[model samples]
Target chain A: MDWTKEPEESKVYPATHHFRVIGDETFDAQTLHEICKEYDLRAPVEAGNASSGGKYRSYQVSVHFPDRATHHRFHNAVKAAKGVKVVL
Target chain B: MRIAIGCALAMLALAGCVTAHIDYPLNDVKPQGRPGVAVSLELKDERYSDKHSVATFAHKTGTYNQGVEFSRNLRDYAEVFGGAGTAESWYIAPDRLYWKPSGPMEDLRDRLAEHLKRAGVLKDAFRAGMRDPAGDGGVQNPETRGVQNRGSGATLRVALKRFVALKARRPGVDTFGFFGVSAVARSREIVAVKAEWTLLDPAGRTLDNGIVEFVEDGDGSCWRAKNKPFVLNNRAARRLGDELVKALRP
Candidate 1:
């Protein structure tokens, strides 16, 4: 879920937030890293589980998000990457 | 992405040619008479009805009428199809360079439907199709055949009897050969469109039934995108639309 809908007090500025991303094989660690680096979030985006069909890969990351703006931008960027089906 | 673009262009194409109506029953018999003043319309495109004609799409690539007989590229069937013969070295499918409408007549049909609507003619449209969750559109299929009308107006069903096109090979391109020695002399395009419309009263008896026909023979430069033929193709559809308006409203 995006922070835009969440209560501001719950965000606790300068916090570490976890993001779960699902996409095709192209949305691997390196591909996600490009955006994390640009947004200045924690690096080494980790590859996680494969969907039941194995057609898609899941990625997990818990990084420092300075504010909702950065988190939103990072989410949008990930969503736009090649083969990326979703970003949460 | 291509579907999105086609939808966008479909919106634009419909904005123009704001005049017409469309077809049903895959009619071979002549239409008897005109339907009453249409307050609303339902449109159907029957391009997929004829097995001999194949609609073109970017991702699907253009395949000859018979699938097993030809490769997706120019090399395989060029040898046999009387349309165009290509040199053995030509490897790319011409579709790689030119884009064709998945169904041009369908696009034209939408344009006509839009015109009818603006004239205070119809209610909402039954879009072509959609994905799983709430799939509701006039997608041609066995189940779709049974889709009932909104019970407010007449129905228009359009069918393509025949369409064929041949474009001249590009300049400095000797790898592709045409059936004729001169590419310009060989370029050809044809379109045949038929629409049968039916209006039924609330009691389910036929109010009116009619047919509109549009046909053309022309030529294009090498690709579906390039020249004359595509323009001629659009013009031919307009001519057909004009006839429907005349027959339906006169």
Candidate 2:
């Protein structure tokens, strides 16, 4: 199927979305928390398991957006964070 | 000795003939400032004819790699317009939710989000609803509820059509196993790539598209062999990015 041409399915507005972030050992969770707070993300950031190698950590962040614009704004901001390697 | 000289000369001549071309059709619609439009970008790999197997060596070339490069460039470029945005920047292994811990992929979404927040494109919200079990406990605006709005601006989907890498070779003088005394030349590798790109909106409507082709002859020197393909493919990817930007406008 040509996904590029398909219309997006309807999504609930002002809904809570979860973003998972993975970073290397050098990553500081506190800094990320501060940044999330700055964006008005109220949910407590949840930390996940560290890789067996102890080289990386994953964090689950939940935030609510009133509209698509706000969601994107928050998304872009988190994507630009230092030491952040991936956002799922 | 004479044959080796001739082969070297031929390779030099081939290197001199390499060129790049970009073909983009201009769109009448000028890019207007959509400060409110939240742009979400997706990159899909369409290079494989069958979903089950890998692309053949001939079909693999640098197209997927270049597609990746183009996506990064597009995301960085799109940031200037400023709005809510998301991108599929990490490579998910087949049947895997995330890359194995040792793999090199980084979480670009969080990184980009942090950057945008710092830039002040995203506003800070009041920490009023932190423990909503339904995931719907945030501030809501009555005016926006029940509206069929996708985002403020538009969602862009880039489907990669073709990424082909080709090599041209010519026979050269050969020296036997005993090398130091006699000079023998081997076939020289000349590499080239062609990439096709298409841009679409959320509804699958075509926005803009283009094709870019580039060729690079291996410099006749063997010392640079290791880096030649990397350098050449990067050039091709950059060319593709340039054309995409032109087609996208904003």
Candidate 3:
């Protein structure tokens, strides 16, 4: 809608639901945090730790969304970003 | 600027390429038999590595390590549960963990179902709130009533731990020391393992208990890895679940 000559506007969705990501070293905490900040979502890694192995560190990441649509967009975008393994 | 843009695009491409394998329930089927069998599933917190600091004359050294130990105990538990045929019904919460299955659970459940089905046992697994007496012994039904009152389908809890150690020995020459020879030798070893599990009955009663112990000798490896009690915990649960189902068959 701006002077950049963009056509139709894309849909902006509300967030709901939560997702867990089990990844290798391909993606680090910093990279994931940046992505979460960009999408207005909470990474909530500490919470995941409580649920998973406490001191036995695994590359587990959990993120909360407002809805399915928002989750879908973010899921796709994150999976496509850099390093990620199993995401649920 | 162009290089930065290219890097961003590459990163995006990578994220999209990741894949996950999962299964979702497609249809509901009625399970045969009386409801007295209990299926237990449990998840436990992971143990961290031991840390110790040594102070020697104004100098200190610290050692740290971390990782999870995988276990295959779940399979054993499943074997015990699947012994009953259509005469008894097994109960467990039908979650993604139940249906889709993960590494150990997936293998354990699939194998149990296959064996149970072949043995002419295995009726149906039910979810909470959904009543189906004819399906897996309804609430009002005697069998179902007993199970409901008894509290069927719960996870068994367990705790596991691990450790590493070293040893020393006399050299072969030491054996000949009596013959005027002497020798000494030092060896490095890694010993690791820790685990414990608690069994629960259908009525949410703490029925029996089991323990898992593992010891592995390391060969001078800086990093030692072991998966015992974690695996054993699953086995214990399966065993307890199967036995409970068999014993409670009405």
Candidate 4:
């Protein structure tokens, strides 16, 4: 059995999804909070480390996804937010 | 007299090489909307100039082709995707650094809305509330208007930051000719645009914001030269719309 390749239906619902968003050093944490609030998700946005030159900032966001669709929607919203450079 | 004749001949010869035709799928695929989500779209034309000079002798006049088409396609895509519908409005602020919605802007908006409807990009449902503009040509208040009336959905604000159309022509030597008519090289036109979009909730709190850039090219052919900016800008606008939808869809 390949644990890494579990079937879609086998995955549990209402799971916690972690997202890492990278942006410029000036990226606003408040914006991320507002976005989470809009989707009615509870996520703690924590600052990570800055690039060597301090030109970029990385933040870790963990939120509860009631379904796969909600998870994708949340990811998309974060991906499109201003000042966000990358999402992982 | 001789210089004038030479210039006239040159102009005549170059005329055929000015136009090019754009080939892309204009209305092929319609995106499906996400169930229970509605989007209200406001397209703002923020270009400050109407004419761009590629060279001392070559220039192109501006139009809102890209902005209008992008808004229309977005509206259609959202509706197709199971979203409730789209409330559409446009604000044109040409030749000014700041935006002030004006009479001409309102006229242009109506013309474009009608054009989109005729192109079949807008459905009847989307057109319902848009038909009667505010007495001043502004869109009716969103709270009381079309799809926006649906509770607690997304609002998309798309601003056209920059739109430029450039044409370059290089002289060619006379070669195969019956009467010394100089052969001309085909001129190429490029259209580029920068668009910024922000997604907000019903209460006007920003959910996300981002910018996208698009550039497309067409060469001088009878079709392209005649359609120059329209062909290139239309392609770029369509591509930009697709990118925005991908970024927003679940």
Candidate 5:
């Protein structure tokens, strides 16, 4: 189970890069849109599955990142977003 | 925070084809649907499954009558460990344990993939351990040979380590000494499956790797059930899928 190889560089840019935002139940459509609004883009955010106790929720976002820098910036921003536990 | 904030970075990226297919096969597909079912057992881990054997005394041969030596483990023989039909076969090295979805386990891989997809753990799915580029078992195989979009996703594979189906008696008793131990009353087949799994990204990076082990105790059915070898293996696959899901936490 140790098949480790260097990951190929992400070349398919200007494409729909996906992210799963894991946060509390309050991380709903409004929170997502508000955080992503600074990028001047809005895409449908799919409210994903919830934890067994319903305390946490996960959302899937497929927005376009025009460049690698944008991708990294958006990833760091989401990771540091309030109430968000993990940006994967 | 100091990058890409209204800086208007120059975007001179190359134009290329892209796939925007976002069909939820788990929800859209019907019950028992077999789509892209590629589950193989050719594990990448080169370790032996039976690295840890039980008590050395458990390796005794089956005998209807043997001396009551506490030092000798009676779990290995059918005399004290009657029922469960036969012991499960553990795979060894150099065995090409590649498998394709068929028969009872036709929907196993697809279902597992969909479960992970629903959990958002995996973005793309491919055939399990068999082939990365979806090709036959021949020379010039796989996409590493310059085939486009073949090895551009995550792949998962599992290998069977052990299939223990033994029901041991606490006290080593001879067949006559251990009377009235009906196979029905006692659990027969404990389909103990030990499997190692590896999840790799598009670049062959090991995203997650772990071992999944579970035991299915004999229920009302399957007890003394004369199932073919393939049937047992199919059931093992089914159990392995569920265990895999639990082991693979995002």
Candidate 6:
């Protein structure tokens, strides 16, 4: 939590970008898993953690992009992928 | 004499007419509905020179909890979709107040751009000439939709801040004047952190503001082997974010 507590000499790793994508509740978890596999990222399923009050459980992805430029590229590609309703 | 008397009476009547009156009941006005859902996110302030341990504890608790929530829920989903390396970038100078590196900030900004672009609210998100020219173009990630024109021309820019617990209270014997307590209660330490966000429109108009607070009660028993407080906080945040996004759906 206190990231700053770490020393300055501590090497900062290559930035890992975050994306929040919204989609239909009915979308299959397995399919999402497959898509991640194709993209070379890991997909972890956490169904119970989402708010039950909302009809659908939201999914989150943390894709590794070498840099900002690559992150943009990845974002564009995901946007074009099938079954995505929206991304945030 | 008659004219003078009449004038005096008239003056008294005029004075009475203009006199202020105290109304017992107040006017009734209809309240408007809050149309949409409001969501807020904030980065904890990390001033290096914090003198108090309480402040430091509050900041760390908030950030850790938020990260866990985001990772467990959103990161999990993203990973399932092949985006496994999603995590927050943080620097804990514990000594410095604000030292978030540019790389992390840019990473977050890019992600936000990607989300907005997909939502079709990119253009209006920032005011005229205030928009990030670089981000105006589409994001480069694989899991997003290109910039679509969401023509409402209404968008929001959010300035985020971490939340801290200032006070807490429990109802005592006295109904109206009950004994109050602080967030940091003794024998059972309670810590709280807040995520404060402020939203503004593209035309430089301020629109909305909100705060999300995370509270944790100390574990005295150690019998149950409580889950790491940071991890629980993170998990909760993912739930909170998902709910927030749903509420903000345009």
Instruction: Name the top DockQ candidate.
Output: 6
- Runs in model 2 deviating more than 4 A are A1-11, A40-42, B1-250
Q: Model 5: DockQ against the native?
A: 0.01
TM-score of chain A of each: 0.74, 0.75, 0.51, 0.78, 0.71, 0.51
- Candidate 4 wrong stretches, greater than 4 Å: A1-10, A40-43, B1-250
Least accurate stretch of 10 residues (summed lDDT) in model 2 chain B? B175-184
Write down the TM-score of every candidate: 0.23, 0.26, 0.24, 0.24, 0.28, 0.27
Q: Candidate 5: lDDT of A54?
A: 63
Weakest 10 consecutive residues of candidate 5 chain B by summed lDDT? B176-185
Model 3 spans with C-alpha error above 4 angstroms:
A1-16, A47-64, B1-250
Off by over 4 Å in 1: A1-11, A40-43, B1-250
lDDT ranking from best to worst? 4, 1, 5, 2, 6, 3
**Model 1 C-alpha lDDT per residue in residues A1-88, reported as the tens digit of each score:** 2211322433235555445555665655677877777665553576655533465665666567676566557767777888775443
- For candidate 2, write residues B73-161 as lDDT tens digits: 33332222121122232222211111101101111233333443443322211101112222221112121133221111100111011
**Alpha carbon deviation, residue A9, candidate 3 (Å):** 21
Write the residue-wise lDDT of candidate 4 on B202-233 in tens digits: 22233344433333333323244332211122
Restricted to chain B, the TM-score per model reads: 0.27, 0.23, 0.20, 0.27, 0.28, 0.23
Measured on C-alpha atoms, candidate 2 has an lDDT of 0.29
Q: Native contacts retained per candidate?
A: 0.00, 0.00, 0.00, 0.00, 0.00, 0.04
- Local accuracy by lDDT, each model: 0.30, 0.29, 0.24, 0.30, 0.29, 0.25
Every candidate's DockQ is 0.01, 0.01, 0.01, 0.02, 0.01, 0.04
lDDT of 6 at B88: 39
Scored by Cα lDDT, where does model 4 land?
0.30
Positional deviation of residue B126's Cα in model 4 after best superposition, in angstroms: 64
Cα lDDT for residue B139, candidate 6: 20
